[model samples]
Target: MRATFMFRAGDVRVQNTPDPVLRYPTDAIVRVVRACICGSDLHPYHSLPETPGGTTMGHEFIGVVEEVGADVATVKKGDFVIAPFAVSDGTCEYCREGLHTSCEHGGFWNDTELGTGGGQAEAVRVPLADGTLVKVPGAVDESLYSGLLSLSDVYGTGWHAAVRAGVTAGDSVAVIGDGAVGLLAVLSAKQLGAEQIVLMGRHRVRTDLGREFGATEVVAERGEEGIARVRELTGGRGVRRVLEAVGHLPAYEQAVGIVRPGGVISRVGVPQYRDAEIGWPFFGKNTTLTGGPAPVRAYIEQLMPAVLDGTVQPGRVFDREIGLDDVPDGYRAMDERTALKVMVKP
Candidate 1:
């Protein structure tokens, strides 16, 4: 099989790799059908600390089940399924609490002892099949692939940002950043019943898409001016809820600045700063801050109906598609912001 790998910073290669096979009774082998390059993959692609060996890239994927070990029960051969970025037991207390990302028995594919990188390959070995794989029902087609693929990561991530912030009908919400996740956050905020969804991003392509996704307004400014814009929009009250989709310190600071006192902020962006203050600025405001890696498995059931019914189109974020061998270009396009998000099909 062939898979994407990173030998060093700024270099992504597709190379022949050993095919995956069931290593545990609870595992399954999946033939990759569709996969995507996530924004987080750029973390390592940029400058992750030196590793003795190159690293495998990619986590978001949907595929057809090829073989399952004896213990695997939730899905079987021929089933079309999606796997969250993390592998989970699904029966753990954390999983039960809808926080499967922290599943006691699970870890990220690249970080776990198994060291298997995900869906970027022609095939993959998935452990904890019952807990990790969400089988799609009925007919499958290329039209639905990107939307279904989104349930594995970006869509669920945005949903987390909105839900964690307690976005409700009649509430005014602002999403910080306008990357794929940020745009999805705008969609999620709308679905969760926000009366006003404001997107803060400067990119014309992304902000325009954000408007399509239900952002009632787009704020292209940043820092103090950005805060004032939100305040002026809300009659000097700021927004009632804020979804922080950019992990950079400036983005977080913007989230803090634009959110009204006593409002909540949910952050889904992978934070890049070493020090971020929450208490001091939040002092006396009773601000509630929540969010982390979205437990995508936990969200699949809640989010799929929308995808299946076409009520929402999270996959619209995917602006470019490439064959598996061309995944390196996909990475380059996303890194340069030439593409909102890239889809790679195997």
Candidate 2:
């Protein structure tokens, strides 16, 4: 099989690799149909150290079941499934509480001995299929691929951010970031009934999409200026809910600065910073901070119906599509900010 491998920073390739097989009774082999290059993948693509064993790429994927292990009764051969980025046993205590990302037996793709569940490959070994794989009930077509793929990560993560912020009907919210997840967060905010949603993003294309996704305003400013712009738009009251979708200290700082007293800052960005002085800013505002790796599995079922019925179209976040072989090019485009989101057809 041909799979994507990251040898080091700035080096990504699609080359021959061993095909995955059902290694455990709880595992299922999936023939990847649609996969995506997430914004967070840029973290390692630009900073990862050299490793003899190249890492497999991609975490968002939807595929057809080519084979299933003996104990995989939740799905069978020929079933199309949506596999979340994280692999987990469905029956874990944490999973029951809808925190699959923290499940005792959970792990992310490409971080395990089975060489991660390389979704960028032609096929992948999906563990805990019953818990991690959600069957796609909608028709399989190019039109639906983007929405289905979003269920695997970006959309779910954005949804988590909105939920954690407790976005309610008629609430004013500001989303920080114009990336795919951020754009999707804008869309999710609308679905949750936010009356005024402000999106902070610099890219014209992305901010334009953010408007289409229901963002009432787009602030192209940054840092203190950005917060001032948001405050101005909200009549100096600041927003009740602020979403920190950019995984950096500055983005977090802006989030803390703009949230009104007693508001919440829900962050779903893969936080990279180690420490911060949250005592003064966040606490002084009486803010409630929430969010982490989205338990996508928990929300897939909750959001699938909307995708199937066309109530929401978060799929608009993906702007480029390519084949598995063109994945390296996709990476370059995203790494250089030339594309919003890159989807791969294997």
Stretches of model 1 off by over 4 angstroms after superposition: none
The CA lDDT at 281 in model 1 is 78
TM-score of 1: 0.98
Per residue, candidate 1 scores C-alpha lDDT tens digits across 84-195 of: 8889999999999989999998888776586566679999999889999999998787899999999989999999999889999989999998988999999998988899
Backbone steric clashes in candidate 1, count? 0
For candidate 2, the clash count comes to: 1
What is the Cα-based lDDT of residue 327 in candidate 1? 94
Question: How well does each candidate superpose onto the true structure, as a TM-score?
Answer: 0.98, 0.98
What total of clashing residue pairs does each candidate reach?
0, 1
Alpha-carbon lDDT, every model: 0.90, 0.90
